[model samples]
Target: MRGLMGRTAICILIILFAATAVAAAQTGDDAVTEGNITEIYSTIDTCDITLTSSSTIEDLVIDVQLVHEDRIIDRETLNVDRINANSRTIKVIRWNVKTSEDGAYKVLVQLLNNEEEIASKEYGFVHGRQVIPEVVIEGTIANSEGVTAVIRPVKATLVDIDYMLVDGTDVIYLAKDEKISIHTTPLTVHKRWNTLLLNNREYTGLVKVRPSDEVNAIVVTDSFSSMDDAKITDVYKDEIGASATIEGGSQVPFDGYVRFTVYDHDGENVVESVIMRSPILLTGDDETVEAIWENRLREGKYRLVIEIIGNDGDVLDIQETMIDVEKSVTISNDITEVVEENNSSPSFLITQAVLVLAAVGFVLRRRNIR
Candidate 1:
């Protein structure tokens, strides 16, 4: 009876193993419910399709067909794996098809479950054989004097090329694959300078021409002070002379010198005047003062002018002053007095008169030599 019980237990274990295998197989099986094409390419032979399944699937077989007017033109088959059950996933399929005919075609994608159509999706595809061109131009723009205006890029394509300028009413036609460069002019109207302007038509933020090079100008301002205020009493020949503080202007240090133009109101030309040289010094607030003026000045009323210049063709500032010049003078005199109280010969007196007349003639001749 014990042997009979052991054989029955072995038979029961075999039936349970078979039942577990059957359940596992059912759970792993999958079926597709819907399929649809997502995208169709005109240049490249490619199409994307989305497929939905009814259950969790590990593998799937897809077939793609291209049809024109109910006639099959191309057909391809693809195998995919690791797809989720009851979920939608995108599958991309590539195929070689003749696109010489400019017409519409239909794409049919089918998901197969055990060699049976479980899901299908359709899409429309069109092909056109045309060449499109694009054009781009990049450069700098300046005014007539080569001053910077604006830098910009001009782009044009054949598809959409109609544009109007911001300040003018001119219609610009940008051809396909065509690039152009235009130098914009600075507009001055009503005494107001407009840096940028439109063409014939009004378009906001039109192409602006900016200066690519640097710009420079000259600025002049004048000031005056006395040497007494400058605390300069004596001036040497070789050394730099007095200095008068210049104020109320914008000046840059290490630029050009402040030329001291001294003019004598009593003289005819500039040669009768004197000029002083000065080195630049740093001051506050964009102002520079120089102790470069020469101290050697003659006694007279003179005019002083200072000018500031830059290396980049820009004049920053200028100054002018009128000063009274005074110099020290020295004089030496010798005098002899004679008294005729003692007795003297008459002939001696006559000789002395003759000698005096001869001396006067000699002095006159020396004056003529000069």
Candidate 2:
């Protein structure tokens, strides 16, 4: 009876231990609330993953595996200790996974407690390759009315750009394999004055052309004498049927004079004349001089040469300018006439006076005849 009792007690103890083990396995020693795979690479045979758990655990183990078909290509495991409670723990497990393999992969990570899986995670992976090219534009030109000038073009290359062109105030995008043409129109006199802009870096030039017809005549005004010193201050010219005001020296009015000359395209002298004039008269510290001229001019292209004359009859400054003469408009005739009935003029006061005098004369004649 004693041996039987001992046997029963041993059997009860074994049953209790098996039940406790089953309960512990069901509850799981560590719970993986979150698991994440951060980065994956195509060329390199590696991946990075992060793991988080609810409570601190000991002997924490992570496994990385790549399953291909029914075979496992690589497997790795790492041990982590004292993972903090409700905190993330990072474990880097290097595996022999081949990136060149043209197949799908599965990464499996497991947290083990006493050689038993308490939490597990799985993810998918892929491997391949790709690339891209670049392009850009380098320069531009302006052309109009058979005349062309180099305008600054875009300076870029195909390290990243596909192709480019400038339109209005924007850079337009083009295909990788495309040709580009850039051009601008010349400025009109009615629109903008003549000017030139150059791009020094790109060795490009832009010309602004103004509309003009022909030069007509050259007129020079009389020289003016300064108050302090007899120096010329300003000069005047009657050009293209209009007067042009020219500036002279600041101090001397009589010391400055202007010479006007006009030449045609064949180099023949058209108008050769000189006028010494001071347009501004500065007296008592006042800095101003006035010059005026009036002359009739014809319509033609002409070159105007202006020379400033010193008091000693020496030329001080000279400038040559081109002028174009435009046609002028003229009104011809005017007439005033009145159409009247019965030979009467169209005047109310004259007609009323005539009627009043006729009535008075008739009354007088009737009284005389009686």
RMSD of each: 27.0, 29.8
Give candidate 1 regions above 4 Å deviation. 1-44, 129-370
lDDT for 93 in candidate 1 is 45
Candidate 2 lDDT over 3-49, as tens digits, reads: 99999999999999999998887665423342322332211244444
Q: What TM-score goes with each of the models?
A: 0.26, 0.26
Model 1 Cα shift for residue 203 (angstroms): 45
lDDT of 1 by residue, 183-216 (tens): 3432211111122221122222122222222111
Winning model by lDDT: 2
Q: Which ten residues in a row have the lowest lDDT in candidate 1?
A: 220-229
